[model samples]
Target: MTERRQSVQQSPADWVARQAELYEESGGTEGTTMRGAPCLLMDYRGRRTGDWRRTVLIFGRDGEDYLVVASNGGADNHPLWYLNLESDPRVRLRVLTERFDARAETLGHEEKQRVWPHLVEVFPPYADYQRGTSRDIPVVRLRRV
Candidate 1:
């Protein structure tokens, strides 16, 4: 985590509360954070709206790096955070108390299948969620910048 990334700020008290619950509890092992995966309140300014959007995301480790997904739990609509990143490209991400400068990039199909299983190890519900919808879930790489 860099000081530059840490400097980005967020709002919405309820969003903050959920973030605390998700990260502190260790991906829902202790309690729930939205979809039962451990979550980190990702704070970013919308590309179009410019309002800060705090999104809760499921994460998995790819070696030392963190990976995120735009599964939306197989929702019909793409997650708002995905659109926000697509519009802006640059981002600030947090995992528990740490913050990092990041850029989200979509992964290839084969890569997604490989990485998603690791995510399932962390939070198993994702495998089941994939079956619920028709859209292809996007797996994102959260590279440290």
Candidate 2:
């Protein structure tokens, strides 16, 4: 007999969790954007709990790869999602209706600088998020596995 599977847990933030639910329930057709910015759903394992977790993040394209900012709304600390991915680079992402396995890499200073402008263009508020924080926001590159 097969055991019952647990559902992926969403972020603790109420709005974020709701958005993730809408995206998944509608098969990526609904809740595709967040505050007018295109976003994606990311699934990864909890660093400590070892449970599947999900969150929504705005993405920018870098060639064939995807880029996401670990701004954490300009907070000094890195976002929990970023830390989880750092612990385990493996991730499952949904961009619109397409879902795929991918690996996450936090870009180095030079690499992030090269793509910074493009990313800002994709989501203008990222520039403000950086200006508001003393810590340099990390830019993570997601490559298909």
Highest TM-score: which candidate? 2
Which lDDT tens digits does candidate 1 get at residues 6-115? 23334345765555555544643432344655665566668876765566666887876678878776787788778887887666666766666777788899988888
Q: Write the per-residue lDDT of candidate 2 for residues 26-52, one digit (tens) a residue.
A: 999999998788999999889999888
TM-scores, one per candidate: 0.74, 0.94
Runs off by more than 4 Å, candidate 1: 1-17, 20-36
Please list the C-alpha lDDT of all candidates, in the order they appear.
0.68, 0.91
Q: Worst ten-residue run, lDDT, model 1? A: 1-10
Error of 2 at 117 (Å): 0.9
Assess candidate 1 and give its lDDT.
0.68
Q: How close is candidate 1 to the true structure, as a TM-score?
A: 0.74
Q: How well does candidate 2 score on lDDT at residue 19?
A: 96
Q: Clashing pairs in model 2? A: none
